[model samples]
Target: MIERTVKYKKPSPKPEKNRDVRLPRLYKSLYDQIINNHYKNALKTVNKLQRLDTDNEELIKTRIFILLQLDQFSHASSLIQSSSQPFAYEHAYTNYRLKNEHLASQSISPDSDDRKWKILSAQLLYRQGDYKSAIDLYESLMSDLSPDTDEYTDLETNLKASKECLDFHRHGYLQAMDELNVPPLDVLENNPAPFPDNYKPPAIDTSSVTVSSATTETPSKLLKQKEKRRAAMHSKHANKNMQIDPERWLPMKERSYYRKPRQQMSINHKRR
Candidate 1:
């Protein structure tokens, strides 16, 4: 009878939903840090989670939260490859990634508020050199063109670019004709002097209007950057004109290899 006797072990109490032994108190601490706006501290907690876990929703969620806060759209997109919950953080991150890839990519659900970040992502996508994507996003919001009007503005910009390309390509043949010293027959018959050899348009001293990309650069603050750039450009250009003598033009707004033409104002910053 004594040999048959056995002892039973009691089961452990269940941990809370937001916290558990598996997740650890560290996550709770991270949450507190997040609430306190201590993002750096929260990031440390996330790092600890990464070291221990292999693949888990909680860890993914933690990473997502951190990435979104830091605006690491590309990083967050990679972490959450595929998830079932559409409304989950992973879904949002996935949409964000897709949007960045192409503004018109159908990442958001049907009933999404395009005005919400869902639309902003499109602008960003274009700004980042994804023209095709940016165009797509603008097309979808044809109805919501009233409020932000970003869609309309962006659309007009894209249209102008398209027209410019068409014009350039269509007239490209003229350059070759002119280069071969082959003027149209009508001109040759009517005028005694054929087009002058080494004949060139008076170096078409065009005052090109620069179109700068609203850059995501060393912005003191995101909202104020554009305003500041505009103000500075105006001042520089005006001052340059006001001075008795203007030196070289200020730095031009350079665009990435593939993107919209960055318009810059040739502002003279030198004082009169």
Candidate 2:
């Protein structure tokens, strides 16, 4: 019988999937840092994660959020601008914060799933003083968005603020001043006639106009007569302000006034 050489086939080694195990732990660290408001630390870890998976959408978004939290608005804007594909929310939001409204509107893709883009767009309109457009958008969003959510709260706040602004624009400062029973700002802005023609302020009796004794004197007067008297008290008592102790004030010889020299101890004295 011819002995057939049985070639032993070595088992194929397991695929190098250990990298997958580290993914969640790394993400957890990122999450923890963010939740604890360790934005700078979170940003460092996020950069590391992005390096491992350069195309990670979530990592990119988190990095943008971290930059925003750290108040690095320009950096966030640059990162969005450098993206290979448009991330509508990030791009629009960063541009919005940068006050680049036109660019933000351009960056907003109509097909984007993020409703935040629409919210940002509406907020841009609100900020640009376009209240009607903003209110319409916000009202529509309010209908669809739940009131308990932050987005809804923001929408409601912006809507209310926009309405107020709208009212102000409609009625104007003069009308508002009249409604609130306050003087109009224009009255302060315009130069008053030095004196009305042939009209003079009535002469007042200076002797009868007494200076107010209260601390709430008009700013034109630095100090009333009573205030001057009170302020002068400090200078008046300056000599008496010294902290001389009564017991220590007794007369003594000049030499006794100084501390006595420490007595020299006799180190070699025999016990007596």
Candidate 3:
């Protein structure tokens, strides 16, 4: 019997892919640990995991999400921005930058995507003079709201507002045209009033009227008395006239005293 050298062959080492495939399960366990508020353990596990699976996507995503939960936005932003797989938050954040339909002050424009990315890249179509596009975009977005309507982007609602705004502007224009088409208040401009050819004012008859420089004679006694009466009547009317009421009187004795007549003049002739 030839003693065939039974060289014990060691099975080839398992492939890197097979080793990498195991990392996610352990990574997820570590994630759960952190999720349970096991910060120290989670950190320790993540450190061990990083050494074990240097570039695992789940590990990275979890790390960044944890950092974000810790309110470390800047660091989270950095990590997420540098992720290998595309992150929804990155997309959401890009939208945050570019502004969604909502126009929140804090949002910025992000990179573009397929039909979404308002926060990052989509602009108000109407603002860009693309009303039809804006309307279409809004309508399309509305159709997707069976479950998550509350999560509608600022962009979608803005598009709706833009549509309403467009209608309002159109209404204003129509009103303006209607006003223009209506007849003017006064159509006749600068037209002189008509004067008939036969129109004539009555002729004045002043043949007996004469202007005089001096009085011809002194008035008779009765005429002078009438003239004095007329003068007195005119003086009575010359004061600012107002209605007098009996109720306005202070008292009977006071009124009688106020109404006392003036004393009559007594003339004395000299008996020389």
Candidate 4:
């Protein structure tokens, strides 16, 4: 019997396990940090994540958000500006925080339908003293939001403030004063007299007028009398004792002179 050479096929090597196991752990760490409002720690974790996943656009945005949370608006703005992708809202928000209204307005698109973008736009309008536009935007947002939510409460407050500002601009006391040509006290004092230069006042006769005794007294005499009266008043009240509670209006616990009684400490011993 001719022995047929049975060539055993080489077994395929087991598929290599993924070597980069730190990616998932880093992601979890970053998420936990962000959730706990630990932006400083989150920033470090995000840097690691960015290194591991260099192509992730979301990671870049997350870093910008972390910077914002840390109140590093300048850094966030620079990062956004340097990024290849457009982050209009984030860029605008950073500019807004930096008080660069012109740059913020230019960066934000007017036609964008994003709610946050709209809210930022409204805030920009409010800052620009465009109360009517801000009020309209706030009112529209309020209608869409439930009253129980915090966002709705904030919108309501903003709406009220904007309405008050609008009213003040349209018919406020200051505006009324301006319309009536009421000069400020300082301006009135500085300007020429309201009467014409040619006008003159009639002379009055002083011989018939009778002066009061108090008015006729010399200033030195008057001052001496006042000092004498003050001395007598002080002497009258000098011996009076303070009988009423000095802190009568204050609560018992809030009184500075009041102290809480100390409790006696008792130790319990256990028998072995």
- Best-fitting candidate, measured by TM-score? 4
Q: What's the lDDT for candidate 1? A: 0.61
Report the lDDT tens digits of candidate 3 across residue range 1-272.
89978889899996666655767776687868876987656766776777787866677776765665565556666666677676764535533434343542234333445554552233445555566666776666666665455557665677677788678766788678777865454754445457799999898889978767345545586588788988877656565466665655577646634543333222222332
lDDT of each: 0.61, 0.78, 0.61, 0.88
Per-candidate TM-score against the hidden true structure: 0.31, 0.53, 0.31, 0.58
Residue-wise C-alpha lDDT for candidate 2, range 1-272, written one tens digit per residue: 98879988999998865767867888899889989999988988887788778777877778888898898989988887887756667777777888888888787766665667677778888888899999998898899877789877877888999999998888777675667854567975795647768897889889987676666666557547668878777775476667865556555434345553344234334333
Cα error, residue 80 of model 2, in Å, equals: 2.1
In the range 112-141, model 4's lDDT, one tens digit per residue, is 888998899999999999999999999888
Query: By TM-score, how accurate is candidate 2?
Result: 0.53
Please identify model 2 stretches exceeding 4 Å from their true place: 1-25, 50-58, 109-114, 172-272
Candidate 2 has its poorest 10 consecutive residues by lDDT at 263-272
Once model 3 is optimally superposed onto the true structure by TM-score, how far is the C-alpha of residue 270 displaced, in angstroms? 99
- Clash number for candidate 4: 0
- Residue pairs in clash, model 4: none
Residue 161 lDDT (model 4): 89
Candidate 1 local lDDT, 1-272, one digit each (tens):
45756777899997655434646677678779888978777888888776666566566676677777777766766666554334343455456455543433445454666465555555555545565656566666655566457657766676456445446647777677668967689988998976878888666545785656656345557658677777876655466445552323533434233333334222333332
Report clash pairs, candidate 1.
Answer: 103-133, 210-263, 210-264, 211-262, 211-263, 212-262, 212-263, 237-267
